[model samples]
Target: MQAAQTQRKFRGKNKAPKWKKPDDGHVSVMVLPLAITDPADLARIKRLFGSMWSIKRAVQRDARAKVDAYWTAFHEREEHGAKVVRQRLGLNREALERCAYKHLDASGHLKHHVSKALAMHMAAEVWNGVQWHLFADATGKRHGRPKTGRWHDFTRIPGRARSHTTDRKWETFRLVGTLHGHKMAYTDGGQYTVQQPRRMRVPAAPSGPVLTGKTLASGKTGTRKATWWDHTGPLAVVFAGGPDSGRGDLVLPVRIPQQPGQWARVEHFLSNPGRWHKVDLVRRRKASAPGGWVYEAHLMILGPGYTAPAVRERREQAAALDRIGGVDGNVSNVSVASFPASLDPADGAPASTEITLSPEERALLEREAKKRRGRARALERSRRATNTAQYGPSKKQARRAEQRAAKGLKPKAVTVPGGARAARVDGVPKQAFRRDQLSVNYREQRARQAEHAASMAEHHRFRARQVAREIIAAHGPVLVVEDCDIRTWYRLWGKRLSQTTPGLLIAALDRECQAAGGRLVRASTWSTALSQHCLCGERVKKTLRDREHKCIECGLAGKRDLVSATLAAFVRFTDVDDPKAAYLDTTSSRHAQIVFAQGLEEALRESTAPSQTTVRGAGHAAVPRQRRETSAPRTAGRRPRATLDEPRPVRDHAGKPGQRPGCDPQLTLW
Candidate 1:
């Protein structure tokens, strides 16, 4: 009877659908705090982590020792047969396990899965070392033995490398448990509760009914209502169970940090249950927060779905017919120009801008450097003071004490510079805490400096992106940029590299272009040769000292960079070949251009400018013929005679003396 009633309700055309289909949604992890109501449990958790860290350290040490021993043996008997070498140095997996497994099994409290995971992580590191050595032997090794003291050698690499041990005390634990619906449990007595969170959707008002625009005419307008719905995710946080529960079981309840309305949504999700996914354990390490081990449960639930935004395809449309904006990214600043082709060439000039660090930012950097210097000075002074307080006895006093001991006489009292407490006699003193506190202060100060620098860089990048968007919007949708190598600039200009980050700016522009239904065209840096004029299909080369391009052939005069930008736009939208092709110097590979997006060939045919023609057989490609000769008539073209040293004519291999060795005698080489 209930199914018949529902079918009867949807029988007519005006009937409403039973349900709406939803789109697929994405998953994200939500971080939440764990509630630890018992101090004893917290202590146990701390002890557990400490023991795990010790085991991790031991594993790392054993792996490194094995790697060092294996490498030493390989180096000693590199000429021996493979079988003999394998026998001499037992470097197989079984041998390694035999050496390291004993230590892992000795720890009774360490879980078996935890030990296995830790061993795998350490073995991965050892494998990486082996791979590095193999690569070094292949590439770094020249002649016979490998290069010992080269700059790229691993041993010669600068900076300290830490293995296993780190400042952060957190470890990622793989879940070994069974999950069912909203409830989960582990063999080791660990458990957690899971649920879905909620979020507000678009076209939603805080709390009200939807309104029509007609009410505004009567001066009684109101906003539309916003919709609230359940938000589903893959990761559900697991918190330690609250106190006053069962003492024998080890289980944690789901405690999410969210608004009250979200809490209600979670409760609804919990009531309905869902499919189990995965669970991850993370130990919170924040000094200010309540400390406890937290678990993140991954689950899938049936609820409202979501669809990702569509990515616009790259195409030429009416939207691309706007003015062009060309950006020249330099080491110290960026120059941008947005203009129409109809605009006067004389009026076209790029505007340059740069970011300068504020006084406060600079002060923070200086303060960090000063603190480090002061710490070094203080440590040196403390070392001297400690030596004076602990060992200030004279040579005669020391000899008299020894002589008195031999004669069984009482020794005189010795004086110290400061006090006995100033030196470490038995163990570390309370005053040692001051040094540790100083070290922490230094670290915090350094962190603050780094944070400030990062903020400044982000601010500059945001500003540049904003300016690029505005220019593209006002002028045209087509963005032209030069590909830059920021690393090269960092090496050549050092600190000045901060003022310009071409890659970051270009990436930001790409996103803005995609959002605006436009496209970003990255031209070759060799387009810099555009600074030279192309007259009669010939390029005129000039030195860097030349700021202005004065082409005598075409009588064209303009600023170098402006001409380069114009030529860049022309080369992009047309099929004009680069005139620098004949003169490209390949000796230094550093300045080579990295290829990027090229303009469409169809756009070239649509252009009004005349296309260039290639004169293949012409001599002296760089110099124009009109300049090469003034007295000679235009029709009289001369060809240079080939020297004897040039390749001889190809003879027939069938005992034909007149023919050269490689080619047919009838064939004429161009």
Candidate 2:
């Protein structure tokens, strides 16, 4: 009946309602740890999660099987792909859910583990995954087929909104100031009252009809009445009674830090005008925790209308308002150049900077990676040692061993992959090997590797954000960057790109720019060709090995990335939505030549030794060797035949000292 009313209400509307984007400066998530220390309570929560996971897995498996069946039948008939099969069978999200209900719930498989509400929720989630595999997005990119989820992947259980007798909202979870005292009673029948902190106060219940006003198509105002709940304080995850009647709903206190700064942020977010939509209970593995797992509640608050005052002030500052920046992101480093927004040639030379991992940072990352690799190798060895029958000699190795036996020769030990010896294997390799008997050491090493990877990823994100903030602070929020695909660079420089994630840096820059009330304009790499052009408007093609942009047309010379960034400063898009329509502004480019030259000179003067700097690539201008004047005139005598203590001259890869390969040495400046 309620669904029919909703349909009738929207019958005359031209378009359906769409969800608002979260990052549009309104929605925010507050992550609070769940305090579940009681052993019985913890056991109950784990059991609840296990049930949810079982239901979710069943739904996902059934949905995938349905999709595969449809795809196979369609292909057999007309050779259609998955996407086409989905369209032909009308396998939309609703269709998938209906199928799941008919196959799983109606057949009594899902209800055996969870309630109907929870079962439907899991089915809807599975539909989302199936849709990703069976559909092409607006950009024509189809996601890879969904794989069977492992137990660890099913860590989150989503909760629904609060329930009202008059409204249709179902309350799978609720927030209260305290759990029932009976739930915490001891064996001796003594009960204790658990008082929550004042900061964690629950909102008062609604007193009257809640009406949200809106503008209708007739230009008149209308109000929609609805029930909104405040999801703060201790969370109670309600579960229906199973075979165990003693077990009840699981209640966990939300742990808000008492620290002033953190409390203030939480206070601001909660006190602001917003509606708490839902909460997600997430469980994560922690080696140091009591049970090897920790739980957190991610509360999704809508329209919080919260922004840090410092960020707003920074965006409104004179420096951020008057400057425009450009970024040239490479595999190992990022080059940034900022010019005045006015684009006047008379403005002082542009400020330029290069960002890269410091030597200490590089060493730390390398050490962590080395440790992870060692752990991985140890894990592989443990697998092979525990399950020897599964990892026997390969086909070639077995054949060679048989041949040696027939020839009456002793078996020669040969090193195989994973540093194992072929002679150690007693039989040929199994076509289908299953590693079922893993050692405790293997599990420990796997946990350690996962921890290291998480820490490394966090470190990378921190460094990337730090670099972005520094750039935005020094230059401005407005930025122009070439829309080059970073994935292509991964194919060419996988190791370097992984160590220094330039894509993460660019994403950070874009996010910071957006947060500061400015935009990161993506100029088309195909159209602008920032790297192939000079600030003087000369197009000079160069190879990947040519790290220096030495244009013959205008005699402009600088490090390739720096020069590209300088040219990017002048790129402008005719259509902001269409990056392909981007072009370099000739007037700005002509005027920026002087600024680029001055900046290049300043960089060269302040640069360190050639080997230590990225600015002076191969064939770049070198600093002059300062010859000291000798006070004692006759002591020069063939320069004492150059002792071993003296430094060797800089050399190219070809062993030619003090000269560039395949180019005559030119001393235009020195």
Candidate 3:
């Protein structure tokens, strides 16, 4: 009834349908478009892109060889052809790229004459561009026209590699066919700019001033809400520079104190740097249009009381010099781009926690960044554009233009059923990451480490086992390590073998016991009777202070503490002994069938001596008849239980109930 009520509550007025459907409303999906502005900065981006693009030909050529080599290496195949290719040419990534690039260009551009020369130079002959131009053809005459085909500049656009440039961008340079790196390049600050396709996507709603006449469609709202930015990433920062920027290097000095009384290397550091530091920042302002009041902030170290310029400068210089060189020299990641309020100057304190920008603020920053990038790109395109109005094109040129345009067409994609799923449009984002100290090749690396550990473990086990075997062989068949773990026992003394140690000595004693007409057994876990308690009526097996077994059964008594030990020692040389095994017989050889029966009193007499006086004051301890087990003598190959006096119940001095085992000639439980 309770469950039914719960079901009713869950269903409310509407019952769940058999189809089992849910109608949580769907969320609208948004796609973020990435944009770059600040045309000057485009060069740095281009260089990064160019460096990537240059590998096309080399990549494609080397790609096939690399694939084949990978297969060869992976499968350990040694066929002659596979071996020859892998060993000789498959690993040569650079040469393959050049060949592929040259071939692709020739096929694409139909530069027949240049292909032959390219092929010649690619053959590993010592020749530069000038040397190639001077080389004679088959007719022993200089080619004269030199390169009918231009060499790839690797540092340009639309090209394969991470950085190949297409003819559209490449042809914009004045020295289209020159080998110099600076034919059509211009510099802005530390970055460079070059001609790019004017058709590159234009900005839709740029920040600052609106340049284009393109209007926002009537149906569009005041502004499409900007994409919420995740300020989780480092700030997108850029140092400003223009055509008028000067090209001078800044020198930061550091000093090192020499040993003893020697002069320090302060002067040398002023000239040569050990590290780099950014001494400028972007200033903040509320009114400069979109750039909004911003300028570079120069930095300097101020000394206490404004005194000791030389001393302070020296200290600052020494610190700066200590940190120059080796690093990439980029300070944008540091929080210097946002100033004044951002000037949150170095507190010279410990590193702080992360900072965050609200969704709205982050969006604004991104929008501003995009706008700046768009303008920079637009300026670059305008300066480097060529053949814009090439009214009449030669038939050859027309064909080339067609091919270049065709190269830009997108490729068709193949989609498989249920192959892989795209990420969900609405879901909690995955966590951000910090630099976690971890092995790069984790699976393989960990496996290797574990294997090494296991190997060490096995080595230790083997040494321990060997030591145990040697002890057993020398002393007797049965070995006993008295106090320590077996593995530790041998590991420490494995190198310098020992025989007198408890573990080793026990092992040896076992062998001797086994050699005689007895078996060696470990007595390590044996316990001795400590105190006495009552069994049934009023009888108690009392243990007087400093006395042992005070049993009244045989009118016999001795130090009870020594009884269990003596029994343990007997068991050590015998295979089995307990209350039932009082007369038990054991032999290393199967042929020795012997047995003996003796009452506790007689056995104690034999074990001790004839005239040993028994201690007084201890009560006559009576161990019960039923609890008393006596082992029987053996007949030829058969072992039998030996019986003793009838068991009489005893009670402790306190009258608590308990039972005690005594000698029973019936040798069943050992």
Candidate 4:
């Protein structure tokens, strides 16, 4: 099948933007490896490399766990959650719903466009495993989803079909039995083969003679003064004097054809482009003195200009003569001036910077969470199908009468020397009692093995097992948290989401803190999902619906629900927990390391000399800049935000997300 046509443009000489159209000769049709086929061995991939081929075994990363997708999810999900939070805050429902997904559905179209672009571009570096396919519709209009009864496997995941018919079989090579490195017919009537040879591929058009921009008589030819653009596109013809490079002067009118390929011969003859050649100033000595005249360089171009013929037949003849490099149509328009200036680079701007779950965390969420679970369930059904195939009745076994009628067989009892009893299998005679009759069982035995083998082969790969994940996080009161969040009430009870969200911190706890006998907790009013007490936005973990929850009412505070139940739900625990760690670390151990590094910069800055301390502090009474905001004396620990969704983000003078767009100018000033 043909791969997706994904291109990378080389615009002049700059890195092309992710989705912008690029200049020629720099694009590729690409797709995610996993999106195409199951994982393969390194040797096979290397063999496919076969010289000149790129062996980029990349792991496709999902957009959600990366930068933009994470922020988008938060904004979208909380926009939905804000309706209830607004209700609690004494705000009207319509105001909140206006920003909700239901009202802002058009944004989902932009989202789909962006997602399509991202899926086509921005692939990961090779060496990463392929990303699993995860289909998520933000418009999400589906209802009454049904569980499929048939068996499936990873190899059968639906995908945008890769059709081989789309490929342009531009040419064939004699040595390789492949088209673009794939098996295809050779140019000659013989079997093609691959051999060890490397060569650079220069871009070539399939038809007619072409022009390469070069200097004829040393006017200008350094990519700036001359280039090709014709054939129904724009056309410009100009003569140049002096050397082609650096500050060349233009001469009078030059000939350009009204049609494509008419002036190709003249263009080729004039552009004597020798490889690796460059333009440089030539020096000439005066006849009377030894010193050289800088401007006295030789110009091989004939400066004579011709008048245009008024008749069509003569014009056509002139064009034909020009095609023979005769210069018969070098008509005079007007004398040209100096060449134009080169296009310069634009001033660079600071690109967006965002952070979310690390690769490990994201892998667990996108691929490990749902897709892996899907494959597991599919395998479960597959295994059942295999069991049925291996042990279930065949048509021959189902009806003895039918088998007899088909074979027209009435099995005659045979008594050998040992008198062993035997029955014919589908009219195939079995061994009559000994190793002497081994050849008799071959056909029946082969059929049985073939049936069993076909049924069980699907399970001989990385199948999923039960996987569970939890994230536990804390936030400010009147603030919000989100996504696959794991809330712990007791040591064991919890709630988790199917995927990642602002609640990922809470969800993280399932893997990190749950082993200490903590239970995930959730509000009894909700199923630990997006709801009133959950995603609906409330801080009911400390205050109930009746508790007129004011900041300083009684100065009383406590967790309203157990923490364990919160951890279990939002995690989208397809299975109970991930099978990866189980497979890697053995069933008994599940631990990941957290390393600590000392911050020497802050340490050195803090330990600056006492005289330098003036820069650090206004006066002796001034507190350290690194000091935290002091808390007020209270009867209980301060609670998190009332709900996981809150309006607006913290604004700092520096900038949102701590990026100081204005701070860079000061750096140059410094």
Highest TM-score against the true fold, candidate: 2
Clashing residue pairs, backbone N/CA/C < 3 A, model 1:
204-226, 205-225, 205-226, 650-659, 650-660, 651-659, 651-660, 651-661
Weakest 10 consecutive residues, lDDT, candidate 1? 589-598
- 429 Cα displacement, candidate 3 (Å): 19
Root-mean-square deviation of every model: 24.4, 13.0, 39.5, 34.8
Q: Where does candidate 2 stray beyond 4 Å?
A: 1-25, 73-113, 162-170, 178-246, 272-274, 304-307, 345-348, 358-360, 393-434, 595-600, 603-670
lDDT of each: 0.39, 0.60, 0.27, 0.22
lDDT of 3 at 462: 41
Query: Model 4 lDDT vs. the true structure?
Result: 0.22
Q: Mind giving the per-residue lDDT tens digits that candidate 1 earns over 438-545? A: 344443444444445566566656555544443343334565665556677778776545434555666766766655666666655564454454322346687867
For model 2, residues 1-670, the per-residue Cα lDDT tens digits are 8887776332554364544545655766777677766787677667767877766766666666767777678545476455666656656666655554555445544344455555566667777877787668999988766566888777887776443222434455534332222122211233432334433322333345554455566666565443224333233333334333345445565665445345456566444322565677788776666566788887777765455555444445523357766789888767777676776534534656665555555676688678768877778778777765545566787888899999999997644323333232565443334425777767666766676678757866765664565567556778899998999988889987787677888898898887777888998888988888877787889888898888798787778887777777778877987889889886777766664555544432222112211112333222212222354443342121101011123444577676544332210000
Give a tens-digit lDDT track for model 4, residues 1-670: 2344555434485354433222342322111011101122222212212210111111111222232242345565487664444344323322222322222234433232122211122122110121121222455443222221111111111112211233322111001111222111111223543221122121111234545467777765434322221121111111122122132212111112223333343233233311101111122212221111111111122221121222222223222211000000001000000000110112110010011223344444455346545655554443333333222333444475466768988853222212212346664325432223223233334334434444432221101000011011110011111222234322233212222222333333232223323333222223332221221123234322432222132232221121111111222323323311111111110010001011111111111111101111121211111211355433233221111111123233433654422211100000
The predicted structure with the larger TM-score, 1 or 2, is: 2
TM-score of 3: 0.16
Q: Give the per-residue lDDT digits (tens) of candidate 3, residues 1-670.
A: 8887776333346354333112543222111111233444334333333323333434433444454454546445455544455445534433553564465464532232122323322322212332333345666765232221222223222111111222222111011111112112212231643322322232122124322344567543343332111111111222112111242111111112223322222222112111111122222222312222222222211111121233233223222211100000010100000001111212110010001123443455466557656655543333223212312344655565577669985443222111222224564222211222223233233334444455644553443333222222222232221122555645765422221123333343343334322334433332312123111111235533434455454233533332322232222223243322222111210111011112223232211111101122221121112111345442332312111111113323334334222211120100
User: By TM-score, highest first, what's the ranking?
Assistant: 2, 1, 4, 3
